[model samples]
Target: MKRGRLALGIIGALALGLGGSVVALRAGAGETDRAELEKRWADAPSRFVTVDGVRMHVREEGPANGPVVVLLHGSIVNLHEWDDVVPLLADKYRVVRFDWSPYGLTGPDPSGFYSTPRSAQLMDGLMKALGHDKFAMVATSNGANVGLEFNRAYPGHVTAMAFSMLPLERPSQTRKVDWRLKWMLEAHKAVLPNWRHREFWRLMLEDTTPPEFTPTDRMVDQITEMNNLPGALDRQAQYIQANVRAFQSSDVGAVAEAVRVPVLLQWCSFDDVISQSADASVKRFTNTKVDVINYPDLGHFPMWEKPEKFTRDLRNWLDRQPPAPAG
Candidate 1:
């Protein structure tokens, strides 16, 4: 066979093998109890609050009157995504984190709304309820999207924001999701619920990382355990689908154009997705006070993979900003 045909054959074989792996590992896979999962993740200031009909898990730290710093995590992760970085800020800033809809201990959305506007409103309410008026935010991936919306809706309330990444340009005119890729994700929504816990962790950690970073077995085990929590996948699937529509709407990118506060854009050296966006953000925010920090050796989750470096860089930026408003 020719080289092109030979490569095609190998690709097909790998795809088939991956499918087989999912099915084989799914056998006897059982869901975990919600109570057990919640018990494991929620601790020390982590508790549930009914925010606009959604019961979200929130954790706050530092003095009740300190400058507020809200940590917003990425997709498929929870408030605890800040576990490595929160301690660094908690001593001085009033650090707050919360489990968003269909992720972490928060569970599904009671309102069935997963768009940026809905999420931004919910976050605003959460801050007000906590007695924080002006605050700073550390937002990653999906959370960064919501953070942009929050800043747009309530510009005065947001003093500064550190974005893991963002795109300043408008989205492509082409169809957002290819039919084949969309079909695969939609099909796996069911398979994911039944798929082996380890497989879920592997797929999530599969990309968006530097080539040499090796996730420990312990890290994989912990993520797998959280993913395998009962009812988690079901809620995950629901939010995933809704979020797909939200992406097409480009609400996050649209909101970015209006953000007037100081922003720290953190970029991953090897990340193919966010670097371009980071550059575009510079152009879009020409009139605003914006700074960039390139993580030369890091990946998507810098705070998780390189907490010391991430927190140090973040502190350098945070310390330069104006003091937080008196509580």
Candidate 2:
């Protein structure tokens, strides 16, 4: 009886302390200085469209008549991931870059409907709204898987496809060797106490790329700001948990064997997330000739780390491909 009373007293004290702290914090943050808050959100890009009542943010450039290139950014990154590459491609292709639903400036899916099929449907609507019938595509990591599913679902719409740092299958060498083992090793090293800490912006930027190509301070700041937006972190966590299966289940070999359009598979030799073995496996299934570009020192984000090389290779590949026949 005495112990039970003591436990209750401790619980009450903790509750009181927590409640007081919350009240003090709220009082200190009253109204939030509207001008300052506005300045903080000032860098967020404008919205392009609202599909199914969810706003989609896009950044478009280049001549309207030029060939279209739809860019799909990786998980946790906004369209700005293509900032360096887009400008270069924009002059040649009508470049359309957008934040996926429930990411970046687009915000979260209020209905909790986040999946590859749903995202693909949203992209289909977005492309039509933007007056595009067929377009080329470039995607990395989670975006690459989304692009693959999109291409499979809408083959008539995607003309050519490029994938960077994408996993091919579940329980493969990459999955077993790269992710699972690495996670365990890192955990043993005490590098991250929790998976959420693994998502830290500084660690992602610093640890996942070539030293020479570390993201600029401005780029890091932009990414971090987007991450801190209301509901952004939660949305990212949900996306990772929900969509990781897509990466695991992706039959890149089957897709490659079935793909009729030209394809490009690029990877960084030192990629920490998706292993090079997976790249080799995916390459084996291509019906059309695969243009494999390998970067030795870069990590998972080769597009950002080696923008010039990636752009040049992409342009060369695009130039060599025969134009699509008219419908």
lDDT of 1 by residue, 1-327 (tens): 699999999999999998787766565345566787667777667777888887778998887777888889877667767888988887888888887666677756667656556778888888888778888888987788778878888778888889874534322334233454455556655675443446546545645566677666655665666666665666666655666666666544556667777889887765554535566667766447889988778777787788888898998899889867745
Measured on C-alpha atoms, candidate 1 has an lDDT of: 0.72
Q: Please state the error at residue 123 of candidate 1 in Å.
A: 0.9
The C-alpha TM-scores of every prediction are 0.80, 0.76
Candidate 2: 10-residue stretch with minimal lDDT: 191-200
Candidate No. with top lDDT: 1
- Tens digits of lDDT, candidate 2, 158-204: 88888776755532343324354356546523532222222345556
- Please list the residue runs of candidate 1 whose C-alpha ends up more than 4 Å from where it truly belongs after superposition: 1-29, 167-196, 247-252
Alpha carbon lDDT at 184, candidate 2: 55
Q: What is the alpha-carbon lDDT of model 2 when measured against the actual structure?
A: 0.68
Q: Which 10 residues in a row give candidate 1 its minimum summed lDDT?
A: 169-178
Give lDDT per model, in order: 0.72, 0.68
